[model samples]
Target: MRIFVLFVLALSFFGCSTKVPCNCKCPKCPKDESKVFVYNEPEITVYKEPQQLSKAQVYYKKQVSYVRKKAAPYWGEKAQVADKFNYVKYAKDFKARTIINFQNGVIRVETTDTANPLRTLKEVIASTLLNTQNPETVDLFSSRHTIHVGEPFLFNRVKDHDGEPIRWVWRANRYAQHLIDTGLKKDAIKTSTGVKKRYYVTFKMKQDNYSNSSELNYASIVKKQAKRFGLEPALIFALIETESHFNQFATSAIPAYGLMQVVPHSAGRDAWEFLTQRPGQPTRNYLFDARNNIEMGSAYVHILFNRYLSDVKNPENRELCVIAAYNTGSGNVLRSFHKNKDIAVSKINRLSPDALYKHLRQKLPYKETRDYIKKVTSAKKHYL
Candidate 1:
């Protein structure tokens, strides 16, 4: 970098005829010619807005921060343990948390309130151990969990790994001192370090991208479904605009069919059964029928609002999670809040919606899901 700067300085000096005399008598250096070189500096890139974070990025960061703190006392500059495993090695192991969860079924985060049970992860977790870094290499359980949320449990040496538990990481003991220092006790230990935050109205879900023009296609049916589902017509329109822009036959790489693009096998099947109480029904392709698509999509979103997001008390918080889950599955969305895979919604239901949103914000596993949440939620404002 210094060499490049020096080269630039040399060029500038030579370019400035008045600053220094041209000593070289070669034809390249013309004494009579007034050499004036205008230095048009390269454009500095500026990012206009903060982007919604992906699940991997969030968890990786959280895991790294956590590992750094816990591994510090052991792997500091002056320690014998640092010889065999440097801070780097220990840190990498902590990152293996996500992998740990899958290999050893997702552990419950335990303390006075949570559980720290150790069980072997499902087969799905180990199946993709060989190829997680490759984006093209899709893990079977990739659909069930984003690899970034990391493993559910921290480094539990006594149980899963053959090591001693980091004393500072003990929730029961650390939290007692933390309460004495702070004066008030916390409800549950934070998944990681730092003061727990409570975000209310101020927090917005991934901001939606506003479309210049709104859709008028199937306007009547959209309003009818929205009304039946007790949703704002604009909210439905926001999803429609984001999903297929009222394209009744729109399909996706996920084979999401029709206007609302409900995945045939998952939400679509459930929504279809919910809208129609019968067994025999075409799922994947027939969702192309505009009315069926709208009913199913709207019903699914409504179900999300009332069921999946029921733990979220605030209307807006519930709305944001619903919008995100519509793109990413609800299980994936819920799992993001706790490091443990089995955190029940009822446990944190009373907590403000913003807490969950912020906790799970950057923590959403998939980049597509994170961006989708932002765009749909941002678009929701315009609809409102």
Candidate 2:
């Protein structure tokens, strides 16, 4: 009985003592399985907008200052300067907000409180339109004011814009109710960083008469970046079309950001280092800027041409490889031809530009990358 008791005691001690020594200075040792281990990542906040030259010189201007200390746009719609051309601002009380797309000449306003919704909505719309920089670009007086409400009962009341211009149109949108419900639910959830954000669902506003003339929204920036990097502006335009369709706030699960879909770790890090002679990942706000996005994307294309695929003989053929490299990588472009780098370069040089395009379309590993190269090349002609 004594020997059995001794063996049981030894097993219990060994089972509970399976902890390894840790060098961390925390009060609790992390190596111990019995104790809880929690790791909280630090949050990044961009305080200032990245400076870049613009032709129009229309900077981001706030309409009204918030009384509750409105924070900068942090991956939310509450207070986001979507891009140089678009802005989103929420009222101090969080009951009302406005989304203004200057390029497209559209203004959207949402109010949570249905009581006197028209009054709140009208005030917000008028204030936003008057205070916006470059009022000529938006031309809200000529542009249509579309007010959407989820509540069916309020649609008639809201449409009574009382002595306002005929431009005010109210529509009943069921999605608006869904948006409010979703925002309330999000407000209830606790965040890991202990910071709660209210996210209201937003819809794409209809384009006005002004959008047709403003098709090439960032053409000036494209020209400057292309000239600086020895690239055709048409190619940049094509890439923007294929990548994000010119959506400045576009982000992906791969975590690529902005107009050109630049991955911060890969293309962003390389382009930023090359441009500034410093090594660091660009913040979200930096990439969100239309000028900075085009510059970084154009710079990466330049790197692909001059650094990686420089050995290829024909500039046109080299551009084909560059496009593929932009979607995939330069290594994969080489691999598409041959396993060895030297042999791949030699083989690529031997093929005519047309032949190289055909080979790439057929041999590239990913169907998406293969399709990507074709889409960019095809879209390039539209810009030209």
Candidate 3:
């Protein structure tokens, strides 16, 4: 018994004295008695510092100057240059710096302001060119200048109302003429004219007083359809702008047709069949019908909105997600959602739209998307 007890004690001592392996893997001990286990630190990845824009500012300035020279309209002696950079004037007084950069044969404008700088620049350039006697040359120069400088033009409107509730009829006519000469169509103006006189207008030699009359006429239809599907007029407008630029008969390179740019396959077999079943329409001619195209487009947008609603909490964010999904597939939007889940919901929601349009010349990805949001929002704010 004593011997057995002694053996048990010996076993306990041996168990207590023996070294146990750690939960983590340990380095192999050396053969020498003096050796001790040591752990190496984890390997870390080092990223190179990002290049600073200040270092390249001088080069950018020189390049801009060269472009401005090239954009000047040449007479026999010297090219005429506009004395004042309209955007620069606004920038000097405003909170943001509007930079127009022209690189790689693309015209891009960037600004820190909340306003849509690209659209503002487009309006500026269009107005300036329209005012010039030689519109073709001005358009060429403006396009080249925009591509070179990567700058956006500032938009400014002067008010002529003389503190009266009703303004003079001649004054209203003059204002209308100014708007027309500067390429600001009636649809673009927001101020109410007290005059009731009608005026004639022409675009590309086609006479039309109201360019967006059809869009306005379809507003009732859009509002009803949008309300039914829990959609916004702005979303409809954005899709319309992207798809057909408001042209009912516009066809894309992919052969998508009508105002909403609906391709048959994208609409699904069921949607295609339903769209083709409309009375008094040829079976193959469905794509040419504006009402059919808009219906399909709105339905598709609604479908996307519903799909993303599960992942996105905010209604506004869900709409943006739908917009992104409309541009990039739903799969891409989902992937982006996973990758940028921690980012602000607003930023994540705009990812696919930004990515798909990142390379567009007049439309800088984020800038254009933001502008689009603002424009649509503004239109809704005023009209809806």
lDDT of 3 by residue, 1-384 (tens): 000111111111011101222121113211222212221111000001112122233333454454344422211112222221111111211211222211111112222222453344333333322221121222221333222121111111112223221123344344435434554322221112222211112212111322244356357767776775567776786567554445444433232445565544333322443334332222213544455666767766665554223345556556655655454333333333343322434454455644433322233233434345444444444334
Predicted structure 3: clash tally: 13
* TM-score per model over all chains: 0.42, 0.53, 0.36
Candidates 1 and 3: which is better by TM-score?
1
Model 1 reaches what TM-score against the true structure? 0.42
Per-residue lDDT of model 1, residues 239-285, tens digit only: 87677654444444333556676655446545554456443333544
lDDT of model number 2: 0.53
TM-score of 3: 0.36
Superposition error at 361 for model 3 (Å):
14
Task: Give candidate 3's error at residue 347 in angstroms.
Answer: 10
Ranking by TM-score: 2, 1, 3
**Deviation from native of the Cα of residue 363 in model 1, angstroms:** 0.4
Tell me how candidate 3 scores on lDDT: 0.35
Q: What is candidate 2's lDDT per residue for 1-384, written digit by digit as tens?
A: 000111111121111111322232323322443422111110011101122211101221222222122332322233443333445555524445666554444546555433655455545544433332221222211122223322221111122113221222231222333334443222322323234444333333333333222335678999998887778988998888777666565544344667787766557766776667554767656776677888989887886686556678788998999898788766667777876667888999899999999999999877888899888999898778
